[model samples]
Target: MSKPALLVTAADLAPQALALLQDFEIVYAGKTPQPADIVALARRHDPVAIIVRYGQVNAEAMDAAPSLKVISKHGSGIDTIDKVAAAARGIEVKAAVGANAAAVAEQAMALLLACAKSVVKLNDRMHHGHWDKATHKSVELAGRTVGVVGLGAIGRRFARIAAAMEMRVIGFDPFAKDLPDHVRPVDLATLWSEADVISLHCPLTEENRNLLNAQTLSQCKRGVIVVNTGRGGLIDEAALLAALESGQVGMAGLDAFAQEPTPANHPFFGHPQLVLSPHIGGVTSDAYVNMGIAAANNVLAVVGKAVAA
Candidate 1:
């Protein structure tokens, strides 16, 4: 008998994960897949499962894959998949939770350090043959307070690292449990008013979209540094740009944005105080294999197949 089809919405999958799926025929969606591409592929392949990596999955695509029993995410965030639509069709939606936690947390730390010390700016000056030692001053992290939003695996790990640096770590996440002893849990208001740096690690939901818009930014301490390794929509880019321009925000380090491959003309560019990365917080070599394995397991378990021993 022919094996069932499993569709992956990326150009490639880790060989480690592919090795475990020997029983299934796998199909790959090309890089930069769009919604229509996913729908078309679903209709053409009629896959039994879909591993979402880079596209939106909605009811239309679900209807196209009648045999699809599960939709698995390569990473923790599932905001790209329409959960309501999947539930209506009895399709299970699963995420590889914490699979990339260490990678992303380390990235958040790197960004925070880069911002606080003006590492990027100083490097540019050095390359330009202008010594800035006489005029440059970097913020001290040891005595600062960092407020973390969303105390999940990534958030908690970042908080722990911040505490090690002797920085006060306050966080907010009503759903988080077993938080570290050093992480003080506080309300959003208190975090905004008291934090020297605000870091976002929350998921993107309708209620929390633009959570760091003008109003919230205003509530924050002036010259507060901002770090986001979370969803891009969590911070309003326009507001953040304005704050950065007005000196209300001292610096920003971002690994995510409202748009993927943020356009060349985007307003956030040309600001020395702002540091940007291509949303690669969880793209480490180890995370690739870990997330791939975990995503495969999520797909297998939901399809009533036992994972290999």
Candidate 2:
């Protein structure tokens, strides 16, 4: 039998994943391709499987490639892929979740601390010779109440760290049947009302999109710090801006944005209390390799008619 053929989107294919391709041929694309473009490309390979990242896999893409059997995501968050489309075509969709839990959790902590210490403000003041240390205010993490949304792998990891810091941890997850001993389960409203800090770790879904809108935010304690290492659409950007303006929310640490590379003139670009990272919550070197390898291995396993963790 000939080697199983594969199509991969713009990502460095790891050697471990490459090794699995020993029995398969591989095709590569630099970035997401349009519907017609993907069809034309698929004609050349007639690949058995296609792997993509945050790219649409609409009916057109599948209809163009009759031989396609599986669609695999390079990381967690299936919000980008059209799972319904894949399923209708009898194509399997698999994601590499928990592959970078540690990386995301660690970055969340880094942002939380930065917000608590007002690190960016202090650093900028010192750079400009303001010597405003006396006016600078910072809070300790130990005695704060941290509300964690979505008690999944990353959320649990973050909660663990918060507990270690002596912070009272509250969690909310509709799917959670049982939670860790350290985290106290609470309703969404209670979490918003009681938490001194709130961290979002949920996925982006229709029911959850803009979950932290104005109404929900109004229930938060004044000066509540917010962090989101999850999805950008989970919070309402416009509402968040208003809250920041009125001091309803003291600070925000964002690793992901509604739009990537956020437009140059965006309001968040120069916001003092806002600490923004380039959606790199899961971009650690270790995470890169692990997720890459797992995605690749999953492709191989799914191609062979099996499931991979």
Candidate 3:
């Protein structure tokens, strides 16, 4: 007898993860999959489960797969999946929460350091045979304060690292129960006003979308450094641009953007103080395997099965 099909919304999965799903026939959706492409593939495959790695799974795609039982996210964020639609259809939606936390937190740490030290700018000057060792003075991190938004796994990990640097770490997360001793919890207003460096580690929710806008930016201390390894929607790009130009935000290191694979004409491109990456914070090799295993487990559990030992 033929096995039921399982779909992965990426070109590939970890070999270890795939080995555990031997009971099903796995199908792949190419990278950079569009909504229409996902819908078409779902309709044609009628997969029992889907592991979303790199695409948005909307109501249309869910409806296309009649036999779908679970929509499993490859990483922590489930904003790309339509949870309400899945619930209405009696389909389970699961996220591999915290599987990539350490990897992302490491990236955040690097960005914060880069922003504080003007690492990229200095490197550029050196390449052009310019020496500004006497003129350039970078911000010292020790004893400085950093307000971390969202004290989840990733946020907590970052807090630990910041604390190691002898910096004060204050965080804001109403739902976080396991507060570390080093990370003091504070309100949003307090975080904005007091933090020398502000790092965003929150998810994109209707309530927190554009949480860092012109109004909030104005509340922050002058020349506050900003680091975002979280969702792009958490910031209003226009407001940030103005802040950058006005010297309100001294520097910003952003991994995620409002638009993925940002267009060539994006205004953030040419800004020296704004360091941008292609959102590969969680793309480390270790995180890749961990997230894949977690996602596979989520799919199997929702389907009334257990991953092979």
Candidate 4:
């Protein structure tokens, strides 16, 4: 009997994950995991399981692989996968939840501190042989309020870090109860109005797409700093741009964008008050290994269960 096929959508999996999947006949897809490429790979390999890192696993891909028993996400977000389609086909879907939580939370904190201290702008100015320290004002985190949009693993870690800095930490998560003592729970309205800094840690959903829009920005404190390490669709970019121009928002640190590999002429590019990083909040070496291992384990678990049945 032939070994089961295991397809890897991206080529960057850690060696540990590759070693663990040695029992299966591995099929390496494209370096960049596009939806069409994934579909083509599925059709060619007829994989029993797929480890998805950065592609849209849509109905076409699912339909192409008749042998597919499990779809595993390398990270927590599953927005790119068509869960509805997978469920209809009786395929189990799993995510490596909390695998990169610490790494992402650290990145969020790094962004927040960078925004608060005007780190990027200062570094650029110094490199250019210009010093204009008097013009840019940095705020101290102590005594300020930080509003965390979610209370998941990442959010909780961020809240704890902020609290350690002596910043009052408040959070809004309808689904999360029993928050840490240092992190206060508040309504969205209160969080918007009172927070000096707002860090988004929520997952992207249809209902919360563009959660921070013109209307929501207007409700925030003047000169409030916004940090987003979550999905880019959570903020309306146009609204954020307008708010930055009008000084409604003081500064923004963005790790994710509405569009990946944002166009060269994107309006946010070179914005004085904005700090941008390619969506790499969870791409650290440690996170890569952890997420890869977790994703592989998910596939093994699901496949083992199927075999037993």
Candidate 5:
């Protein structure tokens, strides 16, 4: 049998992850492929399948590759890919879900802890020998109420950690099925009204974008801390900024943003009450390897074995 052809458009996979594709006739590109270029490459190569991450796949990209049978994603979020277009042409779509769940969950906790204790502020103060500890008051997590705004793998894991810390944990997930004994299922309104801290862990769907706006922020308890480890569009930065400025929100820890490589003057750049990260929730070495291998294995399963549902 001839070697199968595969196109890997997402180039951030680690070296170990790249080495796993030794069996395929792989064509790699670091950025989103241009329509004309992808068309010519697909026509010339006649690839069996293509794997992409964080790239748009519209009707044009799909129609150009008649030989393409499957489209595998390196990450859990498939919102970037046009699934409707792919299905209209009979191309199977698969994603490596739950692969980076643990990494994201842990990072959320890291952010929450950092915010609760004012970790960054104190460290910066101490480094300058200003000893501003007199004015800084660190909050404790022990008896606070924490609300998780999604019950997927990442959200559930984060809830478990919060429960272990003796915090009152409540969750809101429309699709929630199996929840632990400690986590009580509640409506979004209840979660917001009661939680001392609220963490967002939902996808960037049309209905969910800007879920945390002025109206929703008004429902929360005063001096609430906010954390976002999932998609950035779920929260409105403008509303968050206003709340932060007015002291309605005590602090925020954000690992993702509306735009990556967030501009230097972005509202969050020097916000004293905010801990901003450059979408590094899943950037750990272990997460890189796991997601990479999972993405590569998904390709093999779909193109070589017709596996992966």
Candidate 6:
């Protein structure tokens, strides 16, 4: 009898995770596969499980895979996968939650520090032989208030880091019941009004889409620094740009954007106050390995395979 087929929709998987699926016939799709490619592959392979990393698993793709029982996300975010559609088809959708929490939290702090110290801006100016030190003033993180939007694994870790730096840490998460000792629980309004630095760590949902828009931005303290390692849809780009221009928002550290692979002519490109990175906050080697293992386990568990301890 032929082995069960498994589809991998990423460029590669960890060696340890791949070894566990040796009993299955693996079909590898290149990273960032198009929607049509995914559907076609599903139809061709008749896979029982599909592991998605940086691609979409929409209704069309799910419908094509008649045998698919499980869809596993390589990381915590499931925005790329259509969970509602999968649920309708009776397909189990799972994520590797907390597999990359530490890595992501570290990245959030790195961005916060970069913005507070004007690291990128100064480095660029110095490279161009511009020695204007007096104009470039950096804020001290110690004694400042940091408001964390989410108190999940990543958010709590970031809060701990902030507290270690002697900064006051506050958090806003409606679902979170137990918060760290260092992080004071506060409402969204209090966060906006009192926080000198605001860091977003929540998943993007309909209710929180464009959470940092004109009205919310207006409520924030003047010259506040913002850091977002979470979803791009959490902030309104146009509104943020306007705030940055008017000096209401002193600086922004963005790892995710409203659009993936942000367009070349996007307004944020030349802004000196913005420090940007491609959405790689949780792409560290350690995180990749952990996520891969967790994703593979989820797939195996859903398929009734006895996952080795």
Query: Each candidate's TM vs. the true structure?
Result: 0.98, 0.93, 0.98, 0.96, 0.90, 0.96
Expressed as tens digits, the lDDT of each residue in 110-156 for candidate 1 is 99999999999999889999998899899999989999999998999
State the weakest 10-residue window (summed lDDT) of model 2: 300-309
Candidate 3: tens digits of C-alpha lDDT, residues 1-309: 677889899999998799778888899999888888899999999999999999799999999999999999999888899999999999999988899999999999899889999899999999999999899999999999999999888999999999999999999999999798999999999999999999999989999999999999999999999999999999999999999999999999999999987999999998999988888999999999999999988888977463232
How well is each residue in 1-309 modelled by candidate 4, as lDDT tens digits? 677788888876899998778778888786777888888989988999999888689999999999999999999888888999999999999999899999999999999899999899889889999888678678999999999999998899989999999999999999998888999899999999999999999989999999999999999999999999999999999999999999999999999899987999899998998999999999999999999999999998989665434
> Model 5 shows how many backbone clashes?
0
What's each prediction's clash count? 0, 0, 0, 0, 0, 0
Please provide, for model 2 over 1-309, each residue's C-alpha lDDT reduced to its tens digit, 9 standing for 90 to 100.
Answer: 566567776645767767766666777765545556566667777777887753466777777778888888877877766788889989888888899899999999999999999888888878988887567668998989999999888999999999999999999998976788999999999999999999999988999999988999999999899999999999899999999988999999999888766888888888887999988898888887778777877777767653221
Better of 2 and 5 by lDDT: 2
What local lDDT does model 4 show for residue 292? 97
lDDT of 2 at 96: 85
Instruction: For candidate 5, write residues 1-309 as lDDT tens digits.
Output: 556677766555667766877666777655656556565666777677777664456667777777788888777777666788989888888877777888999999999999999999888988988877568678999999999998888899899999999999999999989799989999999999999999988878989999999999999998999999988889999999999999899999999888766788897888899998878787777887777788877777766564221
lDDT of 1: 0.92
Instruction: Please report, as a residue range, the 10-residue window in candidate 1 with the lowest summed lDDT.
Output: 300-309
lDDT of predicted model 6: 0.91
By summed lDDT, the worst window of 10 consecutive residues in model 3 runs over: 300-309
lDDT for model 2 comes to 0.84
* Residues forming the 10-long window of minimal summed lDDT in candidate 6: 300-309
Pairs clashing within candidate 5:
none
TM-score for predicted model 2 compared with the true structure: 0.93
* Candidate 2 local lDDT, residue 104: 95
Tens-place lDDT digits, model 6, residues 1-309: 688888889779999888778777888889778878899999998899998887788999999989999999888888888889999999999999899999999999999999999899888889999997777678999999999999988999999999999999999999998787899999999999999999999998989999999999999999999999999999999999999999999999999999988999999998999999999999999998999999988998888453232
Stronger candidate by TM-score (3 vs 6): 3
